[model samples]
Target: MIPSAFDYAAPATVAEALSVLADAGDDVKLLAGGQSLIPVMKLRLADPAMVVDLGRIGELSGVRDDGDALLIGAMTTHHQIATDPLIAEHVPLLAKAAATVADPQVRHRGTFGGALVHADPAGDMPAPVLAADAAFILAGPEGERRVAAADFFQGYFTTAVDDGEILTHIRVPKYTGWGAHYEKFTRVAQQWSIVAVAVMVRVEGGTIAEARIGLTNMASTPLRATAVEQALVGAALTREAIASASAHAAEGTDPASDLNGDAAYRRHLAEVLTKRAVIAAAGL
Candidate 1:
């Protein structure tokens, strides 16, 4: 399949990109990594009249430390995020999750903000962001606004990014002393996860002081397992305690039935993976 003929614009600045988007109105699509939009265009699922390429925007590609949080440029490649020293030191859960996305080549080209804005419930990236309580920075003609990860995702393949807005950066809070893990379940290598769990645990004196759990492909959006988190607090770092807490993994989930597995199977995987992620994150 071929994408419909469309005009293209490559902008060197966020302002220029927003200007282009503004002029193009509702018929334009912004290209970041081209990992999601290009394929959809070729499949004829998306055929915007114009495509604005943000690749030339140098400001939208890097990692910077900002005291309590790290500012990750939207166009930063998964490969870069996966290997960035700052990310590994402050947000290892994201690095671990980014490393597991697709394969080496895809990781080299796919961007972190692109993945999150794509808003695929099954994507591996968003889970870590949710667990870390990250915020998305969106730029538009009206100026910039920060959207929390929990509020950014709206529904299946939907998000807070509007037609004229571009995601410029992701702000991840530093989880300095937390042990984290992203446990993904897939049928084969390079395949999307059927269900995945991201866990970050702060352990104090052999007890779980705080826990954050994020779920992938478990609902219409990347979801925080608040129930599981509440259950894990003050829990002993033992198999029984982990199991009991993980049982609440699917408390408010609405998983879809796909060829990879049915809804019930996904619920079961959620419990299993949540337990594994919690145990691993807690270093039990």
Candidate 2:
């Protein structure tokens, strides 16, 4: 398979990239890391008139500490995020999830921002971001604006990033002392998750003080398990309590039936994986 003929622009800076995108009109696509876009284009699923590549934009890569939060540039690869000292120290949930994305080669090439923007319901990255309550920073012809992770993904393969806008950075608050875990289910090595759960727990006085639970492949968008999260709060971090709370993991989900598994099976996986993730996160 080959992509349709399209004009290409490799911009060296964010401003230059924005200028290119603004002039290229609505049919233009921005390329970062090229993991998702290239495949879609080759399959003729997405054939844009122009592609503005952002790989050369140096400012759009790497991570930095910003006060109580960490600002990660959009172009940073999964391998970078998985291995970054700052991410591991401050946001272990993100680091743990990143390490599970595809295989090592894909991890080395896939950008964190690209994966988020691609917004695959089954993608391994979005759950952690949603759990962490991260903010996505988008740059466009007008200027820049921030969209919270909760509001970013609108539906399957859709996001809040509008025409001529590029996601430039992601801001994640630090959760240094919290217990976190990412539990993913896949049919084979390097396959996308059939179902996955991300959990972060803060325990105090032998009870769960706070909890954030995010689900993958359970809806049209990556979902925050608000029901499960609420149920775990103030509950004793015991096996019985965790099992009771985790039963609510699929309470509000709208999972799809596919070859991998039907909606009912996925819903079951959600509960089982949620129990495993929460218990591990609580270290009980």
Candidate 1: where is the Cα deviation over 4 Å? Answer: none
Look at candidate 2 and give me any clashing residue pairs.
none
Report the lDDT tens digits of candidate 1 across residue range 184-274: 9999898889999999999999899999999999998999999999999999879899999999999999999988999999999999999
TM-score of each: 0.98, 0.99
Tens-digit per-residue lDDT, 89-184, candidate 2: 999999999999998899999999999999999999998999999999999889999999999999999999998899999999999889999999
lDDT values, one for every candidate: 0.93, 0.95
Q: Which stretches of candidate 2 lie over 4 Å from their true place?
A: none
TM-score of 2: 0.99
Worst 10-residue stretch by lDDT in candidate 2?
Answer: 17-26
lDDT of 1 at 62: 99
